[model samples]
Target: MALALLHTSPVHVPVFDALRDAHHPGFPLRHVVREELLAGAAARGPEAVAGEVTALVAELAAGGAAAVLCTCSTIGAVAEAAGSALAVPVLRVDRPMAAAAVRLGRVTVLATLASTLAPTRALLAEEARAAGLPGGDVRTVLVEGAWERFAAGDHDGCLDLVAAAADAVTGADVIVLAQGSMAAATARTTTALPVLSSPRPGLAAAVAAATRAAR
Candidate 1:
């Protein structure tokens, strides 16, 4: 399926690629992201961000794209607005992911990008409550310097940072990796609970929604 994806970080392209490879390798997928989406997430707030995404979705729809997936988790609220404006299926990465993660109580979200972690937690908490766990625990552990190392091409360093954050998730029933870019190289640590990352849940939703809409 063809999808026009808006994202702030370009690293997520590989993450989504990995997800497609894992779950939907039979189908061809197209992905796009701009660095501005990540760097400008805080600066423009919702209106400006939503305007940019809405514009992108409109263009992709014009070009015969099957769906729109916004890759940056932080900008999902904006994507929600854009989805309302766009004609094609617009997949916001966070909501469905939050839904799946909420099914497990005592969720821990490991995030390299600290800027997006708070919202990730809030979304998880809200979903958990709605899913029947009113007092579920949600935790966030920042893997210090993970994103920096990845951007600097120190792939090993990125993995190391993610591994280090594993300590904070020791008691979690559900461990969620908030950012998609880190999914590819995130080093695994022992977890008795379910581990939810951006790639599978988000990519699955995108593929499912796009395929269904196209059908």
Candidate 2:
């Protein structure tokens, strides 16, 4: 059985592919990139494209994916909802990061896009509640102009902005990069506070889920 990944940006293809190669070599992966999905979510709202997102996820599951992972935070909740009715596992990439953040206490979330902020915040709250922790101390920061750079294919510019934003953050036990695309920024950040990104831990979780589903 293969693990299917639903991504909004094509950049994530290489990122996750490299991750799988390094960590879970020989694991089967199926990637589907729908830039329009995130485009619609950003232009309108995530709810506007909920049906399309859900349909795509159902299609992936039906196509023999042992597990489906939504790598976009904007439509993660909707994808997860669609997965609920399926036999296969459907996961949002940010969930593992959120679970980790809630345990750390006082999380500061950094995002390049305004659309990702609310959903990520909600995910953190849900994770906190599930873990019986208070969700009051989480903070969100939008790195101005970073999304524009990312959209223009300037990944380095985006990472620089994210790293700078992370360095500027204060009074937080840990910092969470709201988007998986921003995961590389963790290495560039100068702050001593722990920086959490979804890709590594999230992919690990997906691999484990796929392994179990295959059994």
Q: lDDT: which candidate is best?
A: 2
What is the C-alpha lDDT profile of model 1 across 90-111, one tens digit per residue?
A: 8778777789877766777888
The digit string of per-residue lDDT tens for model 2 on 58-112 reads 9999899999999999999989998999999999999999999999989999999
For candidate 1, the lDDT comes to: 0.72
Q: Which window of 10 residues has the lowest lDDT sum in candidate 1?
A: 184-193
Clashing pairs counted in every model: 2, 0
What's the TM-score of each model vs. the native? Answer: 0.86, 0.99
Worst 10 residues of 2 by lDDT: 53-62
Candidate 2 local lDDT, residue 196: 96
* lDDT score for residue 45 of model 2: 94
